[model samples]
Target: MKVGLVWFGDDLRSADQNILWRAMQEVDFLVCLYCMEPHHQRPSRYATQGMSENRRRFLQQGLNGLNATLAKVGQTLFVSSMDADTSLNLILNEVPISHLYRNHHGGWDEQQTLKRIENQYPDVRIQIDHGLSLFTPSQLPFNLTGLPESFSKFRRLVENVDSTTPLPSLHKLPPAPSFNIHNIMPWQHQITDNHSAFTGGEEAAMDQLSDYFSTNLPNQYKAMRNELDGWENSTKLSPWLAQGSLSARQIKASLDVYERDHGASESTYWIYFELLWREYFHWYATRYGKQLFLPGGLTGKQTQGSYYAERFRKWSQGNTPYPIVNACMKQLNETGFMSNRGRQIVASCLIYELGIDWRYGAAYFEEQLIDYNVGSNWGNWQYIAGVGADPRGGRHFNLEKQTAQYDPNQNFTHKWQGQVYDSQLDSVDAADWPIYPTSSN
Candidate 1:
């Protein structure tokens, strides 16, 4: 019997999972696997302790759901903390692996890893399918090479294109192919910190979608999305989407149905527009690649002066005296999330307000956020830092002004300002504003 091996990464769900779907079609027996990179526990550019405990716990929960789904369909989900290259080699030597399948993530590190694997195991047939975006790059009207330099142009061309790619359905697993294999790693079971309030798995993602589209909250999304004080204000699907627990297409489809069955309005389209923005970032990263990670970023301009790790820490911890900025940072530290408006404001403060390098801030977010996607995080950092597509150089948010607009009554700021949320927040105490060298600074 032909054997198929799937090395799952960010694409965690069973539904609409092209990698799993294609694997089932190609081979009679399949081995589903997940490899947790060993380096995940080390200090990253942002979090010194690696991925925060809360994010990992949430991810573990999602992995459990994925495993259960596979089990229901007669498949076993094997997991490891091994490096991709080493693990793929082991699979090749141990199993009758005819093909290796996975999703194509745009990050340079992930691409590099794939290249190394193909080089090491040249005989295996490797397939990369689109499982992340609602519409894959290949499925888009324009190629990455010809993708518009500006988001608006890209948005215009693809706005009306059919995003009808159906989410792949799960199927029963054939008997396991004969192989000399080690026992599957047990799930890293841990209770997620209640502070974060985000759950994992395809089930949780779909449940959240159902709740969002439910009549009680559907119409209020537009007005509530910006409110920072309560979970009721936002869809909160971002963590799931960021971690691959949810697919963008699924969210878009649900929204579309809500519009048709319920009624379309400015709020309905606004959510779709936000999804487009997410698409723009993905395409932007695919087009730009490593440039997105550098200090100057996509514009090719070198950042001025030296970077201070101390100052970067302050911003990450949210201790900077600006209560509004600190409050948003605190929320992120405690819950692994912040509202969209909160994200923009804090990111701007790190760049324009703190005068630190944008990469420092971007890296910090990547390490902490449950929804951290390379494209969106870095793409947004470069945009806010004035290094990416924004012709205006940078998008700066005035903290006091932002506080007035988003947290007008200071309720959002006050919610997390003191006692409970300061463990990490105190690291970046904003006791006094840094002196700017120039008026712009």
Candidate 2:
């Protein structure tokens, strides 16, 4: 009986996980492994920490949950701080392995890592499953290279295409092969006791989905999704989705059940529409490759801005002149979450108002967001910076107009805006700024 190894990357859950299911079927014994790379903890090029404390804490909770879940199925997840290649080498040397199974990711960095592994081990029977996206390349109506540049065109083509059904839940797994490997990486960060709305794990993700759909929230989602704050205002599923604790197909499956039971409305269908947007960005990342990360973005046009360190710092710390931007930034800095409309508004301010390099903002979001997906993060930044797929070239939101409409009563703004600090800018008069006066209503 040949031993097999399953490497868990972003795909952490056992439910709807094709890689884990197929590995269990083919191997007599299996070992589940995860690599905690040093690069993930270090500061990025933009000088922001690669992963924020909030996100790190969430990841730790998720890992602990996954280990407990695996233990129930007679398996254990071995975690190490070593690089993926070194970790895999240690496993192969210690145990006689015949198969390696992993979920495929569309990011350039992730793809490069897989390529390096293949080069190092030529004889291993590696099987890569496309579990990251709702639709795979082969399932697409056209070749990835020829994917439509505009999202609306792409959505029109594939809106009716059915997603493959999610894999059935696994209740048991083959016992892991015993191996003596030490030097397991210890989680050094302190888990904060901050009261967060989200808790990590497969169970939590499913519970959240069930709770949201069980209410009238889905029916009101289309109308309320743009609001600045509130749990019920929008479906808070991205964090789980980003970590692979929840799969797109799983969400779609739940949506199907909801629509059948409650009757489908534009709101019910709108959830599907948002999922398509996520799918578009996932495939777009693969097609564009390294260009997606480049300063020029997919269009190869240079963004018209230079890095302004002080200005960016003020924006990030929620000390900006605009109350709406400040409040949104404060919310993101405090909680590992922000509304979709808030994201667009802040992104527009960074690119158009502050005139800082877009990559810095994108990199900062990567560090801070609990639900950060490389494709969506970078792709959307490119769109706002006028380098990606927006027919209008770029998005520039009028801060005054946005605030008047979205934060009219100043309820959302007041909740997040803390004590005012000294202005980072030298000459700007705080009183002269057009922000909604804190003294008024």
Candidate 3:
């Protein structure tokens, strides 16, 4: 029996899919899989261990939604309790898999995993499609190594380059192996409904796109995107985008519709512009590889600050002196979501005001955010700390100034209980007796 394996990672959706399409054309039977790695359930070296509860719940929803889609085409998602490497070994051992297929992921570790699979199973035909980003590697103006050093430079080169149209939705797929099909639990679309504040699947993502564009919300995105809090102010699609349940082109496709229905405006253009920013980081992470997580980042120039536990805890829990930062932190803790503006305010506070290592802030975000993407999360922290792509050294927002501007009425702060506390920024003074903060990853 010729069997192909579709290993689902960050890319969970079935619509506009490339890997599944090609797999369907060749394989007599296919098995879909998603592996929940051990470390993802444990804590990391920073404030967070693994994925946050909110993040896990959202991921589960994404899986359910994807499984529902696959079920429609006579397939099911086999979620294993092991990590990717272990799961692949076990599956390939049980069945002589003819091929392996997946979408390209930017994380260095994710790429390495696939590379190892290719080397270990040379006979297994490996196919990876670059469907996650708006543009594929061949579509880029320059080679991956020659990617622009800054977002502005990258923007200037690609802004005129149009995004490709998303492939049409899939109506059929290869059947799962008869022996493997019965054991898996099935999910129907009815099992998932819009009950919580946000839903995780591709179905929910498409609905959000349709509903947002059906009204005048896209027209106001640019002006309201900076607000401290408001649903209509922004697209609120990051969580879905981060999970890969909603492809960037899927969102751009909606923008195309909205533009056709109602003429394009600056707000509409800004929507695509933000997508370009995301596309830039996807390439950035791929280009920098291990350096994407380094203290000096891509530049090899180290900056100030190390890990101070007490200070890190206070900053993450929303107990710092800055009310705006406190409010943002608290909002993140309560919900897996945060405004983009809030992320900037809290990240600045962690690096500049509190004197904590920027990686701690990045790691904490990786733990808590429902929308966390390895490239966007780490790349962004590096950007704010002046260790990444920012043309300016880094951003140091005046908390007082930011507070007056975004929370003039203090409504957001009050709702999140962002009360000020008087205390020194440093947990330990330069006593010859006190130990230095540990800065290792």
Candidate 4:
């Protein structure tokens, strides 16, 4: 009897889940697991949390939703507060698992966990299926080593590639192996926290998908996508996409249906275009691996900034000299989200104006963003810092120009209290001596 154990990472929903569907075919009994690793809750060298209170609660909501989704089909999600390696060890010892299954993820730490599992349990037949990405690596037009260096080049090359289809929902799953999992709770156990503008879970993901396409919203997405505030300005499906409640392929499939039904426009096509950018970063993270986190990134070019305690603190707290940057930061802190344009503007301010390390900004986003993905976050940061995939070097947005263009009416700025009267950036100089505050002219 082949008893299977599947470790679920960001991909939580059981519907359109490749691993869950496959496990039932290959194993007589199965265990579905998700570990809420402690590392995510701790602080890193930058002094920000690996995960913030908002992020943690958002993730818990995903787990709770995934758990409930699985329960409807007679399966359960076994969650753990312990680290993944220990939990997998404890389960393998008791389950006699002959097979292991999981959705593929591009995170370095997640890769390390898979390696540990492989070495410890050579006898288990581990199978990884793709649902996280729109296209599997094999489906890519080129080898992973030959992935395009620029999003433009990448987009041009893959313009004709076929879209991927989402797997059908699993109506029923294999029974559990009946082995006791240590430090576990019933599937109904839930930890609720301050919910965000977006709910976390697959059901909500599908609901949002339906609601968005059910309207003329897709036609308007391109024009308003860059807006700083309006909720309907963008697809707003990212939080769910990041949590694996919604797959990239699922979104692509929906886009196809929407285009066919509503008629394709540039806005409809731009939706596809944005997804390709996401697809590029997913491959970018996969190809670069640990380099994605490095300062030099894929290019190995030296970055301009270093860590500055006070400037970083003020920038993060939305008390920066630049009101637009401050507004963007305030929006991020309060809502656990930021518009794409807002991210780039504030990222440029951190790297160029404040002269704080780009990694610090990326780490802060990792902590705060309800929609954080390892690849896109770091890759875009590297691009902003002029160290990553930008063939033309880094981007430095004109804060004044950006403020005039995006927040001309100052509606967004006023709403978020962007006009901070911070004449002095730091209270102390390098020598820890008192520095006179300057007047803002």
lDDT of 1 by residue, 1-441 (tens): 688988888878888887777777789988887887877778765435677776787888889888888888888777877776667778788887888888878777788888988887788899988777768765688777887877778779888876865566676665567555454454544455454567788888889888888855766778888777687887778888877878888888888889889898878877887788888888788778898888888778876524655556666776776788888888889878878888888888777767777777787787788888889989988888878878788888887788778878878777887223334322332666443332211
TM-score, prediction 1: 0.90
**Model 2 Cα lDDT, one tens digit per residue, 141-229:** 99988999989999999998888899977888889876778754322333556488888778888899889888988899899999999
Assess every candidate by TM-score. Answer: 0.90, 0.93, 0.93, 0.95
Which window of ten consecutive residues has the lowest lDDT sum in model 2?
432-441
- Candidate 2 lDDT score at position 345: 96
Clashing pairs in 1: 16-168, 196-335, 314-428, 319-428, 319-429, 319-430, 320-430, 321-430, 386-393
lDDT string for model 3 (156-199, tens) is 99988877788776788888775442223334333443445788
TM-score between model 3 and native: 0.93
Whole-model lDDT values for every prediction: 0.77, 0.85, 0.86, 0.86
Estimate, for each residue in 1-441, the C-alpha lDDT of model 4 and write its tens digit.
889988898897876788887888899888888887888888898758578777777787888888887778888788877899888999888778999998778888888889999998999999998878888887888999999889999999886789666788888888776666668655555567544677788888899998999999999988999999978999999999999999888888888999888899999999999999988998888888999988888788787789877787888889988888889999899889999999999999999998888999999999999999999999999999888889889999999999999999999999999997479887887999956545322
The lDDT-based order of candidates, best leading, equals: 4, 3, 2, 1
Worst 10 residues of 4 by lDDT: 432-441
Q: Candidate 3, after superposition: displacement of residue 129 in Å? A: 0.5
Q: After superposition, how far is residue 124 of candidate 2 from its true place, in Å?
A: 1.0
Best by TM-score: 4
- Which runs of model 4 end up more than 4 angstroms from their true locations? 191-195, 429-441
